[model samples]
Target: MAKKKSGKQPIIGICALCKKESTLEESHIVPKFVFRYLNAHSFTGRIRTVAEPNRPLQDGKKLHLLCSDCEDLFNKDETLFSNKVFHPFKKNGFDGPVIYNGDWLNRFITSVNWRVLHQDLQKITTEQDNDKPLTPEILNTLSNAENVMRSYLLKERLNLDVLENHIILFNEEIMRELFSHPHAIIQGSAFGTPVIMNKDAMYVISNLVGILVITIIKKHPEEIWLNSFVSNESGEIPQSQHFDSPIVTELRKFEDFRQAYIEGISKNQLEKLQEKIRKDPDGFKNSETYKRIMMDRKLK
Candidate 1:
């Protein structure tokens, strides 16, 4: 019999909303386009180097082990956003500022702040118990964060049209080639909310963008897996087609999109980015604009 090469199911945590035990896929802290600028010209198995962003980006692999349903929801949004904004921007080198989902991103980011509160609570309370038991408060903290990230994605990952206009913007004309995925949701009372993407959906996107930049700078990586899946001893079955959606599959296979981004962003773009930073100041940190997104903020 052939032996398995994969690791013990990537400890994908439970989806906070659904409370399912699963692997949390590796999600990017920043989008791929940002990094791609620093990388090579394209994903054509080539690599370039840059100095401004310091070192080369990672192998353009920003992942977060997530269950089928959560992955599906987020990827759906990714496809929509990529086609409308990212793809055009990367291909044409369209100069502009970062776009976002205003209310939803900010609201959910608050939950990440709560996670810190929960952690602090555990730290302070854990000393009191010789054998610390998982308490409701701790659970609430994590759950709160997860719900914030997962619940409002549709609100956050839209283009300016849907965002400013508050429209659904669901179209079938550009469905393009379909992708593969499975049908899965969170189960078992979750430890907390499942939030791979913070209030600013960019947390994941920026990192991927950065890595893609890195790939262009250094060299393109071999593979780019989007919310990959696996089975386990706990009745988990290995599947790829999340809900059997073609859109979902296309998202999972976007190695070139990431590579193109690296080649696309120009030095001129960086200058403008700096100007935006100066204008915004704290706004960037508060907004999804920051490439390295930190989830721990003060919960309101």
Candidate 2:
């Protein structure tokens, strides 16, 4: 493991990835580049939390989770993802379907999944007056998934049994539409919050980059035709697919979120909403139902 020069000794704790007692480093749940894009477009270049838009958070949301060795392992994949997939999409923009290396895509998905689980674990352990406790079953599942992903990242494993049956969707139009608004940029609307569903699946919605990585922890549902794309060994993504029911549903969700941030919340209402979110952060962030009536209303 590469060591960094610092005055203070490394903080000793169980690394999230390796599960070994070691010095844990502060790791960003969402990659730093994502925050950089959000801040660069904002007037003040500061990120505001969705729960509390008034409160600005620096360095995005990070926690002391992984040790240096594990952190370095993720960094390697993060660099490949940023260079090959993320940067290219951001620069030239995707006009049609693009093919990605299966190995790299798998690593990217695993890395995001691991981070999401780590963040959730941190919240479950640290938050006050928590409504929900992290169940042993869920913790075990996440830990097992993390171990499989760590092996895959280190080239100790090849198959992605824990992360297989995945569907990655992209819609450049939604991203362009959201980033057009200055308020949306300031609120970090492009960086969609990660939502873990039922301990069976997770969604890492990156509206900024126009990508959605949906991981199936268990068997893929028959109703979801998108699974057909990944059912085979080949990793070719279509240039465009018909806006099926799922696609429409997801796009509408993004639209609702896009409009919500573009239409700023009032100071008084924001305070109340913040309080509600504080009480139930996961519920508030993960709500799928969008009230169309709220579109007409604005903060005073």
Candidate 3:
């Protein structure tokens, strides 16, 4: 018998969501459109990730987690969301509360949250060093949440039983609170990640530019998440919502990280950015970034 060559095998395995054995696709956990939006509106047409502040990122995180069929399933809802809620809110100047059919909205929210949760679980399993180690009970809860979310995404379940989805609009009120750290808020507006609060809470928060999609996996009673809860039936994403939760503190920490990144930006990069603005002063003044800066200044 011929000796088998030993090398790293291709990522040909089962789809995480669908669980079908096939060649997996490089799937994006955070929708790719989010990165496009960030680049389009950014001053230099470049965006940086929270993990690598100094490195210019062309896309969001991706893994070989899904097959093409499963990927397409996600794309349908993502397109609906981007066209209706996301683009309208971010680009076309339509502010909430925007009405949406429960079907697409629920799928979209579930898809994003499921992807985040799924990826996090994989990370925890493969990597030994966890900042906040999951207790057996918490781990089991997360595993169950992931399974339910997957079933919901795959249309196997009619609803996410105990799971809750919410959209918090970045309107005048929330913007006011975040005004002091304009850079942080601006960066955050384009970011997406999971927010795990030890044994007390767990959430996957996606900032679709100005709109925040928060998937509540678990929560403590004291954590007040009001008005924004997305129902399974048709609902409206309200202009105003309240979040008195540890998630707010997590957001602040993210803002601080962004702030530190901004401060640590090399002088050469700043000069280059300034030069670019100088070359097209009129464009710079009229850009959305400049408007945000002015908004921050006025609020401060």
lDDT of 3 by residue, 208-274 (tens): 7777788888876788876788878898766667778778777777667767778878788788889
Error of 1 at 233 (Å): 43
Q: Tens-digit lDDT track for model 2 on 20-124? A: 999899888778777776565543446665455556555576778889998888887678767766667655655555566546666766677667755665566
How far is 131's C-alpha from truth in model 3 (Å)?
Answer: 5.9
**TM-score winner:** 3
- Model 1 residue runs over 4 Å out of place are 1-9, 16-18, 31-55, 60-65, 93-149, 154-300
Instruction: Tell me the TM-score of each prediction against the true structure.
Output: 0.31, 0.64, 0.88
Instruction: Choose the strongest candidate by lDDT.
Output: 3
TM-score between model 2 and native: 0.64
lDDT of every model, 2 decimals: 0.32, 0.55, 0.78
For model 3 the local lDDT of residue 239 reads: 62
Worst 10 residues of 2 by lDDT: 288-297
Clashes in predicted model 2: 2
